[model samples]
Target chain A: MPDTPFIDDGSNVPLSELRWPDDDLTRIPDWIYTSDEVFQRERERIFFGESWCFVALEAEIPEPGSFKRSYVGDVPVIVTRDEDGDIHVFENRCAHRGAEFCRALRGKAENFTCPYHQWMYDLKGKLMAVPFRRGDHGEGGMPKDFKLEDHNPKSLNVTTRHGVVFASFSESVESLEEYLGPENLEQFDVVFKGRKLKILGFYKNRLQGNWKLYHENLKDPYHATLLHVYLATFRLMVAGQKSAMICDESGRHSTMASAKDDNIEIGEETASQMKSAFREGMELNDPDFLNYVQEFDSPWTVTMQIIWPNLVVQRELNTLGIRHIVPRGPHALDMYWTMFGYEDDTPELERQRMKQGNLMGPSGYLGVDDNEAIKYLQDGFKHSHSQEGIVKLEPEKEGSTETLISEASVRALYRHYRQVMDI
Target chain B: MASTHPAGTNLSPEEARALRFEIEEFNTEYARILDEQDIDFWPDFFTADGFYRVTAKENHDEGLPVGLVWCDGRPMMQDRAAAVKTTMVHAPRYLRHYNSNVRVTGVDTDGTIHSESNYLVIETLMEQESRIFQAGLYIDQFVREDGVLRLKARDCIYDSLLIPNDMVYPV
Candidate 1:
């Protein structure tokens, strides 16, 4: 691809070349919060330019002929598995007109037929047929040189790791392994775990906040304790404790982790309720509350995997899930949360997983609060008050363990986001 | 004219009007409890083991089997109250609930009664520039027991799906 004027050096110069202060940290300007111009630039530069977004898990379209319509940063994409079990992703728009061809959320289809004009496309995005194209005599007919093969939906470069599929609009994007980096791949392993997953269900939430707020919410270690106290009550996560706000070199991938605090002594009332609820309460109701069962090889009680712009692989207890933040508008974002478990999970374990799942999803103990806060954050941005916001909690080291109440991870996100959006 | 009244069932036309007024008052009081953040008193609007669910209409319509917030029993509700009051850190704001169109649908045996009403809630946050956070309707189901009407279920059907911020309180 030829270089665009702004990206001549193969680097996002708008942000990186700025004569910023020599200090290691800086507060992000608030205009990015409620600015329409910033969003449009982001759409062109980052979302449509050079990023391999995780579109769908291979488990979603398990059998051959299964297809699902999704998006990569507001651009419509159709992901399908052909009879040969090969997964392919292509633009969802029809060749004749720019109408969305795949209307259904998901289904098993050999070929897709456009509703507007009777144009047909195969699962591999090949233009199969057009109605009335072979007419014997007609005043209005196809041009003699019209070629169907030339109008096939353009396919994107794809890569898969542990049944997780990713696609890139740019051919220059590094391999999926390198793009995700070693630290990120390790986090992916925590949820994917090299096992066939069972998609329990999907939960969608429309939040009136900037897409950046959702990213910062997950990365910020400051809010978990105060915003979601239900976790604290159950000794799941406690604020003001030893924790890590981790970020990679590029500041894209991040993890907000905390050690299981053993100091939470279970109350008699809570213990009694747990004992009565479970017939065989092995470690379900640990009196000490610090019983980290070592479900994964990691040390964190919960780690919110900030996968670049959209994906967040949340390992919350036994009920593992992924949250994809689809940007709807400058003030709105849709959270598509997919909850999953291993194929061999037992009934009792499944029940526990569902109950624990309540701690995260839309109705979850934490998720709703996050949603409410996001709304307020947007409402605040609509004012003429402040221009710059601070994220200087851990100025010394970008990825160091600290007291749970720190926003270092959020700072890392803004730093990387500024680079990607080039504002 | 030979007029006969049913035994132990005596009420004048004006008395019926007074009963309607009392029911409306009871409903408004429940809303007051929530508006004031008096969550401890809010549970009094339900029975000990009554179910509570605050869900989006989309999920409810599709039988999507999920809610923004779901409390199977009052114990869970109480637990949420305990958590939010102490541990949930969020921006301080006010929720104003306005209820009207109260209708007494039917009378139940044992003096219990079923009723329905409509409501609107306006939320305002106290930032430097006070802003209108959200506005939505509240679909409520009520039951009268022991000479008092209590809320059975309160489904907050927000017309706007995009919430302004993190919802820190029970609607």
Candidate 2:
């Protein structure tokens, strides 16, 4: 017999090779979702170990002294704009010990001072100050020379393009744009719009679910039509539109997009039933669904741009925003949603964008449902089951695809996840 | 003063009474429309150039600034409603808006009335099982036109810092 992999039990592969199920080859073991051990391994192997993650947008820290506290994987990081306006990302923990240096979410700061001791460092991660260096007595004093340069927080490599900022722990990782791939890059530019932006606002919510669930939510386009019925009922998106769930080459990034179509009329009964079921009133003013209709040089009415690891850019009709998922633990996540409009947006157009903004966020009809659904998904995984959950809704194709509905992109996400995690 | 009408909204005692009645009726109708998931009726609550904002207290005060949802003009609001009803999908649920402490604020030179009110909304879903989905407050500002009260701007300030789940409907 050929030398085969053996089980932990002393039993040889000949006895039981763990017969793989052909019918459900795409399914992942349910233990991954519910096991603490798996989550811990994932943190070490994927998050802390390697992989490029989106930490912040270049637009967030435009000024030279501006800085925004963000996270990569589970590690806290500080992305700052130096005097030259170059962006830099550094671990938020102090080098002396593991104390968090920056507590504020965002602000302009010249130097980062450690709260524990008076150790200070400039924005460039260069040590600037150290208190009580020339001590009083010989016993209390340090040796002939003490260098502050030896104690600066470690930093990850950062890259910014078209106003988006990305970082990576792995030196061998490809260029940020290359890692993003074309499909995701196109979706990203849809809202980043290749211009300066004015930060409209930020919304943060503590969700009681796994962070991966949120990523899966964006990759799975089938849920959009059903999860955000408010979008359909209001005639913003229709089944007749040419929509698609696209993924990057590495299957790490995804874009769920669709065009606006008003020609597809619904039956009176169905329309009325839909309208009645969601009661948010379909008729606000007139049926000017095409109100903010400046043609975007793109294919879809909206793009839920899923950047691998953390960021989700929602390029909705006229409004654009980024939803950053910061995981606190296996069962908790903090969703930081930042809404934005261009600096050149006319007051009227800005008003319209703000109005449409109501359709998302924590209170928005569509967003609330997504929050609730993901929670339920995690809740379901609490129980053990013989059958694993399936994201294999469309296994017939690979890469970019067509169809108003399909969870193929989500399956692609899992494929990449398994690859990265070496599962 | 906490009356049936909002404060600073220039409504005479008698006018306040009538306006209060109309406002109460409007709130009830609005809730019914949402409870029934009537997306078509959603836009009708605002004026042609009205504003609708659902923002968090943290964002509003700290200037962290982001709206849960925002609609500047009625057209955008209408589009949202149409989209949600026609294209969006989620588990069905019933939304109940319980509005109280309505006080009329200052009335603008134009018939626009600045009003503020404290309201509580609770949502329950029917999945063959009943579940409390969300509960929050509606902080609103309105205007009266030709004996009709129209919501000029309604900002939903949810007391709970963390949302229970996804809020599928506007407050």
Candidate 3:
């Protein structure tokens, strides 16, 4: 928890600090959120390791020579589409002195030139040229054998599916499809659906909690009803709603789906108990704003999908979007949320998406709760730092379940996380 | 975008001075209620049929329709207030809103005032030092409803691309 500079070499830190509970994924150590060794090891073992991380959307750089800057863990990356119409991702760091070559969020450029010393790279991240390669005024220059090809920035193995792009630092990592697993991919295909995407805009928020908590926040459905009164207030999500947690075989990828049941039936026992927590006299004068237009064939009104390490494809009743996690260090992370709708959406649909969007961003009806809960976690994890936090809501299983009230999904996420992290 | 004088330049010096006084007074009262965390009175500052949005300057410049906080009418604004009270779970913090560089850009045909002001909110959370929560431009349109200035449209375009943690309340 002390001030520690980001060091890639975890060997320097004590092994005692990076220790996890004796139990497999049942108990997560608080130190994982604050340990410098774990944070550094994760960069290499999980992020730069064999795990395929979601870097960017292929739709973001649809045009030839279009590029968008992203990050794989803390390491900056550039996702670009070359003139040949191939999508590629490479380290944003310049080969020369490691300066970030691309500064803009997105732009069209045939070449990415590092401003530090004008070291240029092609769209595929192949180092093209270096200024003064052959000495300027016949004085001094590069050695006759100084090859431009030798200085190419590190590039990731890239793949695109359903308009989303996944990149892996390790060429040996499983293909995007294999890594995402068939079950989770099915839910992903639901949001993407081969339709052209229209990017509404981005809402980036810097959080005080570790990035993993945000991932856990999405995967954990038990907190939804308790934390977000808006969901229950509007009957969007209830205590015992018709829902299912469809987790992938690997327990890495998952989708927590909750269907909105119009045919009301809450037993009196549950009703009286929940009524105490539900906000009374609360009414939406414009109920049309929260109304779901039934865009997807699936009866789910709320779906939070986690494609591990970063990508969170969320479908919160017409507000379809992706929340990309950017982990800064042990205690902080920045969330880059791209709120969008399908290209073929009508004006009415667009309005619906915009109106519903207020339910998810940092200021949304539901989002505000998460922002607070995670910070409270960080605060707890920091000061009174517990050795292990409980996640036994649905103890019988850890991957998938039918109950909306369970921590099984989050427990599954950690189960997969530990496999990769080896904490 | 900064507002340019549309009709204020044509006003008599006396009339302009009086308008400036009235507008400044309204902004002061608005800031006080917000800083005090008076959510109930927040919507009262606007007309029944008003538009309020919190967005980034990048989106504003591009004319993007999306906003961080978008409320079409007083009902929605009231909902926002009610949500903060009932459902919203955010760290309690003290927000001090400072509005300055107030300018009445123009006067509409029916006496609607188009104005712009720069605002900075300093947030002090429990046991944490006060920090710059948000700094932005308030692009506004005000109309006299019953001889009192009520905000018709308030577009708070924050220049910072990233908001800290989460925005519990409006800017």
**Top lDDT hit:** 3
lDDT of 2 by residue, A1-423 (tens): 211123121111131233224434367554555456556766776666556777887778888989998888778999999999888889998877788889987889998898898788788877787777777664565456777777678878888777878887777778876878877777777677656887887777877578888887877766665556666656666555678878898777888888777665765654554444333444544444346556478867788888777888887888778888777666668887778878887777766667567667776657767777776776566532324676666678655678755666666777677666655
Sort the predicted structures by TM-score, highest score first: 3, 2, 1
Candidate 3: regions farther than 4 A off: A1-13, A16-18, A263-268, A271-276, B1-17
Worst 10 residues of 3 chain B by lDDT: B1-10
Q: On lDDT, who's better, 2 or 3? A: 3
Each prediction's whole-model lDDT (CA) = 0.67, 0.70, 0.83
Q: Could you give the CAPRI-style class of model 3?
A: medium
lDDT per residue (tens digit) for residues A322-347 in model 1 = 78778875767888776777787777
Q: Judged by DockQ relative to the true structure, which candidate is superior, 2 or 3?
A: 3
Off by over 4 Å in 1: A1-24, A134-136, A226-235, A264-294, A400-407, A418-423, B1-66, B84-86, B89-171
True contacts kept of each: 0.28, 0.63, 0.70
Write candidate 3's Cα lDDT for A1-423 as tens digits: 332234332223454555667766668778778777778878888888888788877777879999998999888999999888999899999988999879988879989889888998999999988888889889788889988888889989988787888888898988887888888878888888768888887778999889889878877877777787787777778888788889888787788899887554556665576764566456786777778888786867888998778888989989988888888887889988888888899998998888888888888989888998998888777766255787878788878898877888888778777777765
lDDT of 3: 0.83
